[model samples]
Target: MGHWSRGEIERAFRDYSHAVVEIGRSSDWSRYADLFTEDAVYLEHVYGEMHGRERIREWITATMSVFPGSEMPFYRRSGTPSTTTEAGSSGRFSTA
Candidate 1:
């Protein structure tokens, strides 16, 4: 399989990263959940694991609720062109 162009891939990554972070900042669990695949699985090699969009929603909401008023987050007003893929893949987080 051929690789995607660097510019295209990097831009996608940047947009994806920004969206995910901003959702956390806003504590918008539903928006955050909408970004994931139906059966998404996010595994952190260092800490632990999270599976499914529902779980993702719950985790983000809980954390953001706990960290309210510390720092405000802002979505880029854009997002990656999702072609369908895992969002959080180690150093990268995306979907499309």
Candidate 2:
């Protein structure tokens, strides 16, 4: 394990949450792509998984266009960035 303190973890969660919200507010799709890992796997119920940033960008663009307007705000259990390890990957997150 790493030598991360409680405070550090808390800060990380907070930062991640803020970053996610920022992505939703951003008009530039390229900037939104920066938040995700290059090879990140996007899990979904209907379309299943989408791997890599390129796919994610395409998906987001299409979706955003369809929706027209609105921000998809992601919140953690206590409004902090929380992971859904059991859902799939080790650091997988749930948008709740």
Model 2 misplacement above 4 A: 1-3, 27-29, 78-96
Residue lDDT tens for model 1, 1-96: 348987787687777666766654465666877888979997755536898989877876665467545332332234434432443423233333
Which candidate comes out best when scored by TM-score? Answer: 2
Model 1 spans > 4 angstroms off: 44-47, 70-96
> lDDT winner among the candidates?
2
In angstroms, how far off is 62's CA in candidate 1?
1.9
Instruction: Supply the global lDDT for candidate 2.
Output: 0.63
- The worst-scoring run of ten residues by lDDT in candidate 1 lies at 87-96
Q: For model 2, how does the per-residue alpha-carbon lDDT over 3-23 read when each residue is reduced to its tens digit? A: 998779978776776666556
TM values, all candidates: 0.53, 0.64
